[model samples]
Target: MATVTTLAPQAPQAATRAALRTALRVGWFAAAVFWTVLAVREGVHHGWPAATAALLFALAPDLALFVGLSEAPRTARGQLPPRAVPYYNAAHRALVPLALLAVHALAPLTWPPVLAALCGWLAHISYDRAFGYGPRTKEGFQRG
Candidate 1:
Protein backbone atom coordinates (compact mmCIF):
# COMPACT_ATOMS: atom_id res chain seq x y z
CA MET A 1 0.00 0.00 0.00
CA ALA A 2 1.04 3.57 -0.62
CA THR A 3 1.46 6.02 2.26
CA VAL A 4 0.44 9.67 2.36
CA THR A 5 2.40 12.42 4.13
CA THR A 6 2.11 16.14 4.49
CA LEU A 7 4.34 19.10 5.50
CA ALA A 8 1.93 19.74 8.39
CA PRO A 9 4.31 18.05 10.80
CA GLN A 10 7.60 19.84 10.39
CA ALA A 11 10.62 17.92 11.61
CA PRO A 12 12.84 19.27 14.39
CA GLN A 13 15.45 20.18 11.82
CA ALA A 14 12.87 22.17 9.93
CA ALA A 15 12.14 24.16 13.04
CA THR A 16 15.79 24.93 13.42
CA ARG A 17 15.98 26.01 9.81
CA ALA A 18 12.94 28.22 10.27
CA ALA A 19 14.42 29.85 13.34
CA LEU A 20 17.69 30.49 11.58
CA ARG A 21 15.83 32.00 8.65
CA THR A 22 13.92 34.35 10.95
CA ALA A 23 17.07 35.42 12.74
CA LEU A 24 18.80 36.06 9.46
CA ARG A 25 15.89 38.16 8.23
CA VAL A 26 15.94 40.30 11.36
CA GLY A 27 19.68 40.74 11.15
CA TRP A 28 19.45 41.67 7.50
CA PHE A 29 16.86 44.34 8.17
CA ALA A 30 18.88 45.83 10.98
CA ALA A 31 22.03 45.85 8.92
CA ALA A 32 20.21 47.42 6.01
CA VAL A 33 18.84 50.16 8.23
CA PHE A 34 22.23 50.86 9.70
CA TRP A 35 23.98 51.00 6.36
CA THR A 36 21.22 53.01 4.72
CA VAL A 37 21.28 55.60 7.48
CA LEU A 38 25.04 55.78 7.40
CA ALA A 39 25.07 56.06 3.65
CA VAL A 40 22.46 58.78 3.71
CA ARG A 41 24.27 60.71 6.40
CA GLU A 42 27.57 60.37 4.61
CA GLY A 43 26.03 61.34 1.31
CA VAL A 44 24.60 64.44 2.91
CA HIS A 45 28.00 65.47 4.18
CA HIS A 46 30.32 64.03 1.56
CA GLY A 47 28.22 64.66 -1.55
CA TRP A 48 27.11 62.18 -4.24
CA PRO A 49 30.59 60.77 -4.50
CA ALA A 50 30.17 58.97 -1.21
CA ALA A 51 27.04 57.09 -2.30
CA THR A 52 28.45 56.34 -5.71
CA ALA A 53 31.70 55.11 -4.22
CA ALA A 54 29.92 52.94 -1.67
CA LEU A 55 27.62 51.28 -4.20
CA LEU A 56 30.50 50.42 -6.42
CA PHE A 57 32.72 49.06 -3.67
CA ALA A 58 29.92 47.12 -1.96
CA LEU A 59 28.92 45.22 -5.12
CA ALA A 60 32.38 44.24 -6.29
CA PRO A 61 33.15 41.92 -3.39
CA ASP A 62 29.94 39.87 -3.54
CA LEU A 63 30.84 39.20 -7.11
CA ALA A 64 33.92 37.47 -5.81
CA LEU A 65 31.75 34.84 -4.07
CA PHE A 66 29.96 34.05 -7.32
CA VAL A 67 33.27 34.05 -9.13
CA GLY A 68 35.16 32.18 -6.42
CA LEU A 69 32.56 29.46 -5.86
CA SER A 70 32.55 28.68 -9.53
CA GLU A 71 36.14 27.59 -9.12
CA ALA A 72 35.76 25.89 -5.69
CA PRO A 73 35.30 22.15 -5.45
CA ARG A 74 31.89 20.83 -4.43
CA THR A 75 31.24 17.99 -2.04
CA ALA A 76 29.37 14.78 -2.78
CA ARG A 77 26.27 16.45 -1.37
CA GLY A 78 26.84 19.29 -3.82
CA GLN A 79 27.75 21.73 -1.07
CA LEU A 80 30.84 23.90 -1.10
CA PRO A 81 33.85 22.13 0.38
CA PRO A 82 34.97 23.22 3.84
CA ARG A 83 38.34 24.28 2.55
CA ALA A 84 36.78 26.97 0.37
CA VAL A 85 34.70 28.60 3.10
CA PRO A 86 37.30 30.99 4.45
CA TYR A 87 38.17 32.34 1.07
CA TYR A 88 34.48 33.04 0.39
CA ASN A 89 34.02 34.47 3.86
CA ALA A 90 37.02 36.72 3.57
CA ALA A 91 35.59 38.40 0.54
CA HIS A 92 32.21 38.92 2.16
CA ARG A 93 33.17 39.88 5.71
CA ALA A 94 32.60 43.49 6.75
CA LEU A 95 35.90 43.76 8.64
CA VAL A 96 37.73 45.11 5.65
CA PRO A 97 35.25 47.90 5.05
CA LEU A 98 34.99 48.56 8.77
CA ALA A 99 38.73 49.03 9.01
CA LEU A 100 38.82 51.21 5.94
CA LEU A 101 36.09 53.42 7.35
CA ALA A 102 37.92 53.71 10.65
CA VAL A 103 41.17 54.65 8.99
CA HIS A 104 39.47 57.24 6.83
CA ALA A 105 37.68 58.72 9.81
CA LEU A 106 40.70 58.89 12.13
CA ALA A 107 42.85 60.60 9.53
CA PRO A 108 41.43 61.79 6.26
CA LEU A 109 43.48 60.14 3.53
CA THR A 110 44.37 62.80 0.98
CA TRP A 111 44.66 60.40 -1.95
CA PRO A 112 41.39 60.83 -3.86
CA PRO A 113 41.21 57.31 -5.29
CA VAL A 114 42.10 55.65 -1.99
CA LEU A 115 39.73 57.72 0.11
CA ALA A 116 36.81 57.24 -2.24
CA ALA A 117 37.62 53.58 -2.58
CA LEU A 118 37.60 53.15 1.18
CA CYS A 119 34.30 54.93 1.51
CA GLY A 120 32.89 52.73 -1.23
CA TRP A 121 34.21 49.67 0.53
CA LEU A 122 32.48 50.73 3.72
CA ALA A 123 29.24 51.24 1.90
CA HIS A 124 29.49 47.86 0.18
CA ILE A 125 30.31 45.85 3.30
CA SER A 126 27.62 47.47 5.38
CA TYR A 127 25.04 46.87 2.71
CA ASP A 128 26.13 43.27 2.37
CA ARG A 129 25.39 42.71 6.04
CA ALA A 130 22.03 44.39 5.59
CA PHE A 131 21.14 42.27 2.60
CA GLY A 132 21.22 39.11 4.71
CA TYR A 133 24.53 37.99 3.29
CA GLY A 134 27.02 37.13 6.01
CA PRO A 135 30.36 35.38 5.96
CA ARG A 136 30.73 31.71 5.07
CA THR A 137 31.28 29.13 7.78
CA LYS A 138 34.00 26.49 7.73
CA GLU A 139 31.34 24.06 6.57
CA GLY A 140 30.88 26.29 3.55
CA PHE A 141 27.50 27.37 4.82
CA GLN A 142 26.62 31.05 4.96
CA ARG A 143 26.67 32.76 8.35
CA GLY A 144 23.44 34.47 7.43
Candidate 2:
Protein backbone atom coordinates (compact mmCIF):
# COMPACT_ATOMS: atom_id res chain seq x y z
CA MET A 1 0.00 0.00 0.00
CA ALA A 2 1.34 3.42 -1.04
CA THR A 3 0.73 6.31 1.33
CA VAL A 4 0.42 9.87 0.03
CA THR A 5 2.72 12.40 1.60
CA THR A 6 1.34 15.94 2.10
CA LEU A 7 2.99 19.08 3.41
CA ALA A 8 1.30 20.74 6.33
CA PRO A 9 0.16 24.28 5.83
CA GLN A 10 2.10 26.79 7.87
CA ALA A 11 0.44 29.39 10.03
CA PRO A 12 1.42 32.94 9.35
CA GLN A 13 3.52 34.65 12.02
CA ALA A 14 2.08 37.84 13.45
CA ALA A 15 4.13 40.96 12.91
CA THR A 16 3.60 43.74 15.43
CA ARG A 17 3.43 46.46 12.80
CA ALA A 18 1.09 44.57 10.50
CA ALA A 19 -1.18 43.57 13.36
CA LEU A 20 -1.34 47.14 14.55
CA ARG A 21 -2.19 48.39 11.06
CA THR A 22 -4.95 45.82 10.68
CA ALA A 23 -6.41 46.80 14.04
CA LEU A 24 -6.38 50.43 13.03
CA ARG A 25 -8.15 49.66 9.76
CA VAL A 26 -10.80 47.67 11.54
CA GLY A 27 -11.32 50.40 14.11
CA TRP A 28 -11.64 53.09 11.46
CA PHE A 29 -14.18 51.07 9.49
CA ALA A 30 -16.18 50.43 12.63
CA ALA A 31 -16.13 54.11 13.47
CA ALA A 32 -17.41 55.01 10.01
CA VAL A 33 -20.26 52.55 10.24
CA PHE A 34 -21.13 53.77 13.71
CA TRP A 35 -21.17 57.37 12.54
CA THR A 36 -23.47 56.60 9.63
CA VAL A 37 -25.90 54.69 11.78
CA LEU A 38 -25.98 57.37 14.45
CA ALA A 39 -26.47 60.09 11.89
CA VAL A 40 -29.35 58.31 10.20
CA ARG A 41 -31.03 57.50 13.46
CA GLU A 42 -30.71 61.03 14.76
CA GLY A 43 -31.94 62.49 11.51
CA VAL A 44 -34.98 60.27 11.54
CA HIS A 45 -35.82 60.88 15.19
CA HIS A 46 -34.76 64.48 15.60
CA GLY A 47 -34.18 66.59 12.47
CA TRP A 48 -31.71 67.27 9.72
CA PRO A 49 -30.08 70.18 11.50
CA ALA A 50 -29.23 68.19 14.62
CA ALA A 51 -27.98 65.25 12.63
CA THR A 52 -25.94 67.50 10.34
CA ALA A 53 -24.41 69.28 13.31
CA ALA A 54 -23.45 66.03 14.93
CA LEU A 55 -21.95 64.66 11.76
CA LEU A 56 -20.00 67.82 11.05
CA PHE A 57 -18.62 68.17 14.55
CA ALA A 58 -17.75 64.51 14.72
CA LEU A 59 -15.83 64.78 11.47
CA ALA A 60 -14.09 68.09 12.21
CA PRO A 61 -10.97 66.62 13.78
CA ASP A 62 -10.46 64.14 10.98
CA LEU A 63 -10.83 66.89 8.38
CA ALA A 64 -8.40 69.11 10.21
CA LEU A 65 -5.87 66.29 10.48
CA PHE A 66 -6.14 65.58 6.78
CA VAL A 67 -5.47 69.19 5.92
CA GLY A 68 -2.59 69.45 8.35
CA LEU A 69 -0.96 66.25 7.11
CA SER A 70 -1.31 67.34 3.52
CA GLU A 71 0.68 70.51 4.20
CA ALA A 72 3.23 68.66 6.37
CA PRO A 73 6.79 68.39 5.09
CA ARG A 74 7.83 65.51 2.87
CA THR A 75 11.12 63.89 1.87
CA ALA A 76 13.01 64.01 -1.45
CA ARG A 77 11.12 60.96 -2.63
CA GLY A 78 7.83 62.80 -2.01
CA GLN A 79 7.00 60.49 0.86
CA LEU A 80 6.58 61.48 4.44
CA PRO A 81 9.80 60.55 6.26
CA PRO A 82 9.40 57.84 8.87
CA ARG A 83 10.60 59.87 11.84
CA ALA A 84 9.68 63.57 11.86
CA VAL A 85 6.64 63.53 9.62
CA PRO A 86 5.13 60.49 11.29
CA TYR A 87 5.69 62.02 14.72
CA TYR A 88 4.02 65.19 13.54
CA ASN A 89 1.08 63.27 12.14
CA ALA A 90 0.70 61.36 15.38
CA ALA A 91 0.79 64.62 17.31
CA HIS A 92 -1.92 65.91 15.03
CA ARG A 93 -4.06 62.87 15.81
CA ALA A 94 -3.52 63.30 19.56
CA LEU A 95 -4.53 66.93 19.37
CA VAL A 96 -7.93 66.05 17.95
CA PRO A 97 -8.90 64.01 20.98
CA LEU A 98 -7.56 66.63 23.34
CA ALA A 99 -9.53 69.31 21.54
CA LEU A 100 -12.67 67.27 21.67
CA LEU A 101 -12.23 66.65 25.37
CA ALA A 102 -11.67 70.33 25.98
CA VAL A 103 -14.79 71.23 24.09
CA HIS A 104 -16.77 68.71 26.05
CA ALA A 105 -15.48 70.14 29.32
CA LEU A 106 -15.81 73.81 28.48
CA ALA A 107 -19.04 73.85 26.50
CA PRO A 108 -22.40 72.39 27.30
CA LEU A 109 -23.57 69.87 24.73
CA THR A 110 -26.77 67.89 24.47
CA TRP A 111 -26.47 64.19 25.16
CA PRO A 112 -26.81 63.05 21.55
CA PRO A 113 -24.28 65.46 20.12
CA VAL A 114 -21.93 64.87 23.01
CA LEU A 115 -22.26 61.13 22.60
CA ALA A 116 -21.55 61.36 18.91
CA ALA A 117 -18.46 63.46 19.45
CA LEU A 118 -17.23 61.16 22.18
CA CYS A 119 -17.68 58.14 19.95
CA GLY A 120 -15.75 59.83 17.18
CA TRP A 121 -12.95 60.70 19.53
CA LEU A 122 -12.85 57.16 20.82
CA ALA A 123 -12.57 55.94 17.26
CA HIS A 124 -9.65 58.25 16.63
CA ILE A 125 -7.95 57.01 19.78
CA SER A 126 -8.44 53.43 18.71
CA TYR A 127 -6.99 54.17 15.31
CA ASP A 128 -3.98 55.86 16.86
CA ARG A 129 -3.43 53.22 19.49
CA ALA A 130 -3.62 50.42 16.93
CA PHE A 131 -0.89 52.02 14.86
CA GLY A 132 1.27 52.90 17.89
CA TYR A 133 0.32 56.51 17.39
CA GLY A 134 -0.07 58.22 20.74
CA PRO A 135 1.89 60.33 23.18
CA ARG A 136 3.09 57.37 25.21
CA THR A 137 3.96 55.01 22.40
CA LYS A 138 7.48 54.66 20.97
CA GLU A 139 6.48 55.62 17.42
CA GLY A 140 3.90 58.21 18.40
CA PHE A 141 3.74 61.61 20.05
CA GLN A 142 6.35 62.64 22.59
CA ARG A 143 7.06 65.73 24.63
CA GLY A 144 10.05 67.75 23.58
Candidate 3:
Protein backbone atom coordinates (compact mmCIF):
# COMPACT_ATOMS: atom_id res chain seq x y z
CA MET A 1 0.00 0.00 0.00
CA ALA A 2 1.15 3.54 -0.78
CA THR A 3 -0.04 6.81 0.61
CA VAL A 4 -1.10 9.44 -1.93
CA THR A 5 -1.01 13.21 -1.51
CA THR A 6 -2.19 15.93 -3.80
CA LEU A 7 -1.80 19.67 -3.68
CA ALA A 8 -4.62 21.99 -4.53
CA PRO A 9 -4.26 24.00 -7.67
CA GLN A 10 -3.81 27.70 -7.33
CA ALA A 11 -6.51 30.07 -8.48
CA PRO A 12 -5.85 32.02 -11.62
CA GLN A 13 -4.30 35.33 -10.79
CA ALA A 14 -5.49 38.49 -12.47
CA ALA A 15 -3.58 39.37 -15.60
CA THR A 16 -1.07 42.25 -15.55
CA ARG A 17 -3.67 44.63 -16.82
CA ALA A 18 -2.15 47.81 -15.50
CA ALA A 19 1.21 47.08 -17.01
CA LEU A 20 -0.43 46.52 -20.35
CA ARG A 21 -2.25 49.81 -20.13
CA THR A 22 0.89 51.64 -19.18
CA ALA A 23 2.72 50.08 -22.07
CA LEU A 24 0.06 51.18 -24.49
CA ARG A 25 0.07 54.71 -23.15
CA VAL A 26 3.82 54.91 -23.34
CA GLY A 27 3.94 53.30 -26.77
CA TRP A 28 1.47 55.81 -28.17
CA PHE A 29 3.31 58.71 -26.66
CA ALA A 30 6.57 57.52 -28.09
CA ALA A 31 4.98 56.91 -31.45
CA ALA A 32 3.50 60.37 -31.37
CA VAL A 33 6.83 61.99 -30.62
CA PHE A 34 8.46 59.99 -33.37
CA TRP A 35 5.81 60.95 -35.85
CA THR A 36 5.98 64.60 -34.89
CA VAL A 37 9.69 64.69 -35.51
CA LEU A 38 9.32 62.78 -38.75
CA ALA A 39 6.47 65.00 -39.85
CA VAL A 40 8.48 68.15 -39.22
CA ARG A 41 11.25 66.75 -41.32
CA GLU A 42 8.90 65.59 -44.05
CA GLY A 43 7.06 68.88 -44.03
CA VAL A 44 10.33 70.66 -44.54
CA HIS A 45 11.02 68.39 -47.48
CA HIS A 46 7.62 67.70 -49.07
CA GLY A 47 5.32 70.41 -47.55
CA TRP A 48 2.17 70.45 -45.34
CA PRO A 49 -0.17 67.89 -46.86
CA ALA A 50 2.45 65.19 -46.70
CA ALA A 51 3.19 65.92 -43.06
CA THR A 52 -0.47 66.26 -42.05
CA ALA A 53 -1.48 63.07 -43.77
CA ALA A 54 1.42 61.22 -42.21
CA LEU A 55 0.43 62.23 -38.71
CA LEU A 56 -3.29 61.64 -39.27
CA PHE A 57 -2.86 58.25 -40.82
CA ALA A 58 -0.37 57.22 -38.16
CA LEU A 59 -2.89 58.05 -35.46
CA ALA A 60 -5.91 56.44 -37.15
CA PRO A 61 -5.35 52.91 -35.90
CA ASP A 62 -4.78 53.91 -32.32
CA LEU A 63 -7.85 56.08 -32.44
CA ALA A 64 -9.91 53.21 -33.78
CA LEU A 65 -8.62 50.91 -31.05
CA PHE A 66 -9.38 53.47 -28.40
CA VAL A 67 -12.92 53.94 -29.66
CA GLY A 68 -13.66 50.22 -29.76
CA LEU A 69 -12.07 49.43 -26.42
CA SER A 70 -13.81 52.35 -24.76
CA GLU A 71 -17.16 50.78 -25.57
CA ALA A 72 -16.27 47.54 -23.84
CA PRO A 73 -17.46 46.96 -20.29
CA ARG A 74 -15.44 48.65 -17.57
CA THR A 75 -14.20 45.29 -16.36
CA ALA A 76 -12.93 44.50 -19.83
CA ARG A 77 -10.34 47.24 -20.19
CA GLY A 78 -6.83 45.85 -20.13
CA GLN A 79 -7.93 42.27 -20.38
CA LEU A 80 -9.63 42.32 -23.75
CA PRO A 81 -9.86 38.74 -24.97
CA PRO A 82 -7.73 37.48 -27.82
CA ARG A 83 -10.74 36.61 -29.92
CA ALA A 84 -12.13 40.12 -29.82
CA VAL A 85 -8.78 41.82 -30.15
CA PRO A 86 -7.96 40.30 -33.50
CA TYR A 87 -11.20 41.58 -34.91
CA TYR A 88 -10.67 45.08 -33.59
CA ASN A 89 -7.03 44.99 -34.51
CA ALA A 90 -7.75 43.67 -37.97
CA ALA A 91 -10.32 46.34 -38.63
CA HIS A 92 -8.08 49.05 -37.24
CA ARG A 93 -5.19 47.75 -39.27
CA ALA A 94 -7.19 47.48 -42.45
CA LEU A 95 -9.18 50.72 -42.30
CA VAL A 96 -6.87 53.37 -43.73
CA PRO A 97 -5.25 51.23 -46.38
CA LEU A 98 -8.49 49.68 -47.47
CA ALA A 99 -10.08 53.09 -47.70
CA LEU A 100 -7.13 54.46 -49.58
CA LEU A 101 -7.06 51.51 -51.89
CA ALA A 102 -10.75 51.95 -52.51
CA VAL A 103 -10.70 55.69 -53.05
CA HIS A 104 -7.62 56.52 -55.08
CA ALA A 105 -6.06 53.09 -55.64
CA LEU A 106 -2.56 54.27 -56.48
CA ALA A 107 -2.13 57.59 -54.67
CA PRO A 108 -2.26 56.29 -51.08
CA LEU A 109 0.14 53.51 -51.96
CA THR A 110 2.95 55.97 -51.26
CA TRP A 111 5.14 55.95 -48.11
CA PRO A 112 3.12 57.78 -45.49
CA PRO A 113 0.12 55.46 -45.12
CA VAL A 114 2.29 52.41 -45.36
CA LEU A 115 4.62 53.67 -42.65
CA ALA A 116 1.80 54.79 -40.43
CA ALA A 117 -0.09 51.50 -40.80
CA LEU A 118 3.03 49.56 -39.96
CA CYS A 119 3.54 51.63 -36.82
CA GLY A 120 -0.09 51.11 -35.83
CA TRP A 121 0.13 47.36 -36.32
CA LEU A 122 3.28 47.26 -34.23
CA ALA A 123 1.55 49.27 -31.52
CA HIS A 124 -1.43 46.91 -31.56
CA ILE A 125 0.81 43.87 -31.19
CA SER A 126 2.75 45.49 -28.39
CA TYR A 127 -0.44 46.46 -26.60
CA ASP A 128 -1.85 42.93 -26.84
CA ARG A 129 1.39 41.23 -25.80
CA ALA A 130 1.84 43.64 -22.90
CA PHE A 131 -1.48 42.37 -21.55
CA GLY A 132 -0.65 38.71 -22.16
CA TYR A 133 -3.46 38.34 -24.66
CA GLY A 134 -1.79 36.27 -27.35
CA PRO A 135 -3.61 33.73 -29.52
CA ARG A 136 -2.32 30.76 -27.56
CA THR A 137 -3.54 31.89 -24.15
CA LYS A 138 -7.07 32.82 -23.13
CA GLU A 139 -5.89 35.14 -20.39
CA GLY A 140 -7.97 38.20 -21.09
CA PHE A 141 -11.66 39.10 -20.94
CA GLN A 142 -14.12 37.16 -23.05
CA ARG A 143 -17.25 38.44 -24.73
CA GLY A 144 -20.41 36.38 -24.79
**lDDT accuracy of residue 129 in candidate 1:** 61
Give stretches of model 2 more than 4 Å off. Answer: 1-20, 63-111, 116-144
Give the count of colliding residue pairs in each prediction. Answer: 3, 0, 0
Candidates in order, TM-scores: namely 0.54, 0.41, 0.37
Q: Superposing all C-alpha atoms, what RMSD in Å does each candidate have to the true structure?
A: 7.4, 8.8, 8.5
Candidate number with the higher TM-score (1 or 3): 1
Q: List the candidate 3 regions with Cα displacement exceeding 4 Å.
A: 1-36, 66-71, 81-84, 91-144
Give lDDT per model, in order.
0.62, 0.52, 0.49
Off by over 4 Å in 1: 1-25, 66-85, 108-132, 137-139
RMSD of candidate 1 to the truth, in angstroms, is 7.4
Ranked by lDDT, the better of candidates 2 and 3 is: 2
**C-alpha-based local distance difference test score of model 2:** 0.52
Output the lDDT of residue 142, model 1.
58
User: Per-residue CA lDDT of candidate 1, range 2-76, in tens?
Assistant: 998866666888899989877876776666566666656665667777657656765676555554455465544
- Indicate which candidate wins on TM-score: 1
